[model samples]
Target: MCTRYRVGASGKKLAERYGAVEAACDAPGVEAFPKRRGWAVCAVKGELRLGTMGWGFPPPPNGRAPVVNVRNLASPFWRDALARPAQRCLVPVTEFCEWEGEAGRKRDRWFSVPSLEIFSFAGIWRQTAAGPVYAFLTCAPNALVAPVHPKAMPVILHPEDEARWLSGNIAEVLPLAAPFPSQLMALAE
Candidate 1:
């Protein structure tokens, strides 16, 4: 479900790559974990802005767990954020990790897009009492990730589709909720 990921670039590098202006906080460290702060690229007015946000959404009223990955866009809980352009965001990531092997012998398997040092995951964000929180969408795993994590993988966006994911309507952006091509991705040694 992409509970852990890495963003190796600094704020300046992220801003340059995304053509965004640095906003409130510096970029996150190489590794990002749930409930911690991470960098996200958001569209403000006509400009792109890079800022920090917590990684998980607050727990719902039923006392469920905090949401770190969004899989059901049609759910009422996430529909509002998915339908609004302002709530959409880009989660800059260098690599993502999934646990492999048996229950006690699980090991982290890192994956990345070989063609791009940094890529964006289709994300959504909203403000809560604690602070602003963000979560990225997940889809069926691709060939590369299926063996390690058969359930799902983050919905990674190509550089050319970053802007579209931020500004496009639900109808236009929903199609991007598919797995990235396996040929473009590699396993980190």
Candidate 2:
């Protein structure tokens, strides 16, 4: 859902607010997420760590589809791969991109954010022998993002709920996504 974003002064403020310590801005193709560039995954050291994952969530063995949206998690095709809810470290991010227009004449670069300056995104990760890989989980768009991205949006997190999200439990923070509010995120007009 949130495929692209601009990380300017706003990102700096977000980093400080969330106490995002080490930044691993090696998200392979930075353009995939736009101004948010190069897999900007943030970690809280002993607390938690996260970053932009390969947009398409490549399925496990025998599964060739790569799903970036949770909507597919329940699909018969991917339910097997996503049957289990994941609680890995993820930050949906304060802003992301969507497109406007018909397929042939479609326009990209739809920027979305919350009423607040920046919001954290929900994500999941697996413990690997090397380290951790994160993905910005997706969900249906709220009224705000619906017109912009028709498909979905990454799970946006409340600033105060960061700790709870780290636990990987979706129930505790389900209510936050409701009552979507409009934020004043400008695209450098």
The alpha-carbon RMSD values of the candidates against the true structure, listed in the order shown, are: 1.0, 4.9
TM-score against truth, every candidate: 0.97, 0.64
Instruction: List, residue by residue over 1-189, the lDDT tens digit for candidate 2.
Output: 555654333334444656665354443432344222223333344543334444445466786654444554445544332323343454534456676778899676555453655555655444334344445556776676677676776666666666665643345544444424436343321
- Residue 117 CA displacement from its true place in model 1, Å: 1.0
Q: Estimate every model's Cα lDDT from 0 to 1.
A: 0.93, 0.50
List of clashing residue pairs for candidate 1:
none
> Model 1 off-target regions past 4 Å?
none
Task: Show model 2 residue runs off by greater than 4 Å.
Answer: 9-15, 23-30, 33-46, 50-55, 60-65, 72-87, 92-94, 127-131, 168-170, 174-179, 183-189
TM-score of 2: 0.64
For model 2, what is the error of residue 85's alpha carbon versus the real structure, in angstroms, after optimal superposition? 10
